[model samples]
Target: MKKPIKNLGKKLKPCPFCGRKMVFHKEIRINKYGKQVTYQYYLHEDYDIYHDESCILDEIDMPFTIGAGDANPDTGYIGEYAEDWNRREG
Candidate 1:
């Protein structure tokens, strides 16, 4: 069951160093028992988001991170990650 991802039009802040955006994942949907279900999704528009990448590749000091949704919803608060990233800009 491969998880699916969709672009939510959520603008990703440009990297302070490279001014580049990150990557988006892909997903596969299916109907089970006449119910639309998402089998372990990796990305959601308003649910858990997962991302851990450095603004400057290989630069651990300057990095942006988001919550991952695996067995559980580790990060489900929308706009929270962005706030954290922008806050760290200082």
Candidate 2:
């Protein structure tokens, strides 16, 4: 199982449509060049509160700086992406 990454002191705003809290999800992958790429974004799972089982929203992919091997992966992009998404009016 993949563990969700921490928000690094950044907090995602509530969902605009359902007012449910958003969760941060991160994925780390190794490219062909042997660099670690970190992808961080936010997701709002409406199913938890509404029980509709069909609504889901997510922020666009945010890529982090490439890192050597898997050590000290760069996830600083997550904070910037979260800040921008949280300010959305809709």
Q: Which candidate tops lDDT?
A: 2
Cα lDDT tens digits, model 1, 1-90, are 233233311334444565554322333355766765543322222222234533443354323334322322234332445444446652
Error of 2 at 67 (Å): 18
Global lDDT scores for all candidate models: 0.37, 0.46
The deviation in Å at residue 59 for candidate 2 is 12
Candidate 1 overall lDDT versus native:
0.37
Q: RMSD to the native, candidate 1?
A: 9.7
Model 2 CA lDDT for position 39:
57
Worst 10-residue lDDT window, candidate 2:
59-68
Deviation from native of the Cα of residue 64 in model 1, angstroms: 5.8
